[model samples]
Target: MKPGQQDNMREDIYQEIQKQKAMSREKEAVGKLAGRIMHDFNNVIGAIEGYAALISSETADPVVREDAEQIRAICAKASRLTKELRNIAAPWEPESESRSSETTAVLSDKKVSCKILLVEDEDSLRKASTRILSKVGYQVFEAENAEQAFEIFKKENPDILFTDIVMPGKSGTELARELKDSKPRLKVLFTSGYVNEKGKIEEINSNTGLFIHKPYDYEALMKMIGGLCAEAQA
Candidate 1:
């Protein structure tokens, strides 16, 4: 090859590499922003689902109940959109056959006395979850973040640590690890809209820790907690 031609080819390859790196950085930034937005949006949806449940249960009026149900249906649709957003942010591989089957299995209604330490930064969602769990006869303690959660954990020594994955100071996984170090028997259930930290969810699942995605309804929440409580008993 001619010297000029070779030089031009080298420059072209370098430019292509730089361009690829720039695109990668841009994608990473977008993913981070999307993660934050998904978390906030899911929190809103969760709050809506909670309030809708409250309205449906408390109101005797059939029309009001129907309206509440409609709201819940809307929330479900929104939840699916958020799930898509999560995929765009971080394309998660499909769960394995065994895990998929386990998730699909019908959870039994066996009652077991259990205490849950619910930790989430979002206030409305946390309050709604607390109300829903408490209404279902499970004792629930609430905290806004992991630091407060640890304090409650020390005091309550609850059966289940139901917490969000992302938070301001300490992430839920860190809290779970710290608490579990002290009390290995404490069952940990992690919830999140989108996992910002890669493989953390898989790590938790691998360790037999429980997880429920955000914007989950009362029934889903109850089933997860119930399963955890049953596991604790077993």
Candidate 2:
């Protein structure tokens, strides 16, 4: 093959690899979201099962008892599916106990002193992110949208705003802008799964940092949180 043709082939191969990598990342994100939903749904089902059992025992009427029994049976089926989900969602659960214990001890001493408001529209992502931040010793308040986030911000007066760039109601950029207008010193960290051709994310205040991509691991999350907190303290 000619040199130019060889170079073109190599470029094509590189692009293909990049495409594959992106697809793999997307698949991983979907799996993570599925796991989160399964875990939360399992908890809800457990609550329902408990209530149904209580009703079954307390109800004097045979009819009511039968109804409660039916509910319990339905919850049992849901429980089985959630268990499968847990298996998929936390395939690495067995390996993390030691790491988690060590991490907890380390975090126990290094106590992060900043209050953070975390806003994400997706319930799974919001819950997962909140749990990670809380585990790492940061005080994290979560919200599903910009409106709810504003309410929390008012009550919490959090030192930092860690928000998803795209959200229902008002976008993260708008929320950050409005809040910064009032509290100019407020440090912000933006996160998102998508960005448009218009560069909407780049519109976030010049004082703030770039977007942290979605599906971040705990280490990346901690790094972002640490950076934002350190900036605020400085």
Candidate 3:
């Protein structure tokens, strides 16, 4: 191999390696973004499913029930699609409940009246989830970030804290920990889009069932709320 020819080949190889590295970085960035997006998507789905469930429960008309059922079916399909997208971006272990398409019936004929402090950095999702939660008979307080959530938590002293795990500042887990120290009985529902390396949702304490994945259905949310509230009040 001539010196000049060998030098040129080496340069070509270096450039190719750099190019591959750039592509890999880009993929990683996109995957993280997709995971975040999937989380927000779940919030939207939760709102949609919640509203539909409210309608289904309120209306006596068969046609209205049918319409609500159709809406739920579409939301269920969307939830599945987002799951696939999130998996492509960052594959993680899913809970058995997360895989199921079946929606549970409302826990009781009467809506459980409770106060919720909803903390989410995503504005669209924050508004959507709050609206649906309020529509379904819960008093909901909104916060844009952990700081705001802290302020709201101080003032409202809500029964439950429904917060996104990843937030702008002082993550949901941090907020939950601080608040729980002050109010040990405060029921918390921690939600997240991305899973840790271990393929498990991070639990703040022994309350294993307190964690909920994104794009959750209305029934599941309600069930969680009811159970948490009951525990808190107990």
Candidate 4:
């Protein structure tokens, strides 16, 4: 090739490489923003759903119960939209067959007798999950972040650790690892709305830990907890 032609070809390649790098950086920024937004949005949905559940259960009036049910239905729809946003932010393949089975296991009316340590940075989401679990006869202890969670874990020695993956200081996976070092058989169930932590999530699943996406309904959450409790007993 002519020297002039060679020089132009090299410049074109370098520009293309720079363009790709810029696109990658932009994608990362968008994903981080989406993760933050989804985390907050899911917490709101969880709070609304929890309140609706309370209304449905406490009210004897059929009309009130119907309204509460409608609210839950709307939350479910909103949850799906958040899930779509997650996909757009960081697309990934669907859950493995084993993981799918764990989440969709057949639920039972049988009361679970187990202590649960629920850790989440989001206050509303943590409280909602705690209330929902407590209502169903599970002994739930909640903490706003991993620091408090560690204290609770030391005292409670909970049967299962239900935590959000990405917290402010210590991530849920980090807490779980530290706790598991002391108690190897400790069952863990991680939750998150941020798809950016897909790597951490996959690592958790591969290590025999459980995970449920954020904005999950009461039934789905129960299914995961029930399955973990059963495994704990076994």
Candidate 5:
């Protein structure tokens, strides 16, 4: 074979290998993302199941019970399919958000950084989050769960409430609604391991402005908190 022809053939072979590698990498990324999404969905399903069981036994009102049961059924189906359809199938991951930018922006010009009430059931996370906020020049109040957070919120009336959605007694979503009901202008920043399942946050109006997902780095969390808290103030 001519030398030029040999070079062309080698180039063709290299290009084919690169294409296969790209496909393989994409497949791997999708697989990991699907697994993470399913795990979060299961957490939401568990919460719904527990809530339904309580409503079934405790509530005398048939209307409330019916609504609870419907929620339970929908979440159960979502859980089942999230596990079964491992790939990007029709029954799975229809609601996943596109990959958002990693950058987190600060809110408008403000001198005294907003006071933050950090509510998380996990102790390690609570402490770590507190230090992060403090480093960012905010006064931080720490609470282990939603109930404690409520007490703090009442006393401190901190500029912003930072809470975890999946907590023991009172979830973050419920807390946000409760606060907003009492004080229409309450500022809340809710974080979650389960953002997609049940649309727990879709109902959030302007009062509850920001959401941070699990495993978010320090910079991103602060930027989100700063921006939302600034907006709430404005």
Candidate 6:
């Protein structure tokens, strides 16, 4: 090869190595942070859960029992947050517990009247998620896959759409482009248990907001939705 060509190839290899190193370093840092958080949360959650269980076993007083129940509820919320963060901190690993005790902390005191389009291939996950979201006051429209999601998007014109990244047919990213073409301001949230080489959602447009990873807790999910929708409205 010519001297110029050889130099160019060398530079390319060096750049690639640097990029890989950076990615590795970032992953290590994230993993460390996740471990620390999980450790701390486990201690807190265990104590609270244990105490709640004890209180429930012994207490006959309604007020005290109610307080213990409240403690248990708070602990549950913390546990969900910990799990979701752990998921974000490590994309490759899977969480066994399918259920997430996540809640949408609606920003506004007034009614949160926003339409939601949910596109997911997994039947049980879809149904469970739809139920959870609907119960939380989000008017959710369901789609088994991205194709159906698109049809529903046009028909429904939902404020925010949530979809799975990995699908048998059209991927969520492709569907996102189509949806944005028609509804330019439409908000999107992409979730995936399996991420690509880029981590979670591939072909991410920087202009687009957050891409929520799969196994996200209700709190994290709602926070994203609230922030994105709120930004759109603003």
What lDDT does each candidate get?
0.79, 0.65, 0.73, 0.78, 0.62, 0.66
Candidate 1 local Cα displacement, residue 180, angstroms: 0.9
What is candidate 6's lDDT per residue for 1-234, written digit by digit as tens? 999999999999999999999999998787776665564445445444444534543567888877766765776777677766666766554432333332322222334668889887766566656655555467889998887887888789998878776777998777887888888898888776544235333365542735664444445666777776786677
lDDT of 1 by residue, 7-62 (tens): 99999999999999999999999999998898899899989878887777767899
Cα deviation at 11, candidate 2, in Å, is: 37
The regions of model 3 sitting more than 4 angstroms off are 1-17, 93-96, 99-104, 107-115, 121-140, 193-209
Q: How many clashing pairs in candidate 1?
A: 0
TM-scores, one per candidate: 0.89, 0.54, 0.74, 0.88, 0.53, 0.55
Clashing pairs in 3: 42-215
Q: Each prediction's Cα RMSD?
A: 4.2, 12.5, 4.1, 3.7, 17.3, 10.3
Candidate 3 C-alpha lDDT tens digits along 76-190: 8987787778778866534524433334245234555788999887676677677666765788999978898888888999989998877777878788888888888888898
lDDT of candidate 4 at residue 44, scale 0 to 100: 89
Cα TM-score of candidate 3? 0.74
Q: Sort the predicted structures by lDDT, highest score first.
A: 1, 4, 3, 6, 2, 5
Clash-forming residue pairs, model 5: none
Mark the 10 consecutive residues where model 1 has the least summed lDDT: 96-105
User: Which residue pairs in candidate 2 collide?
Assistant: none
Model number with the top TM-score: 1
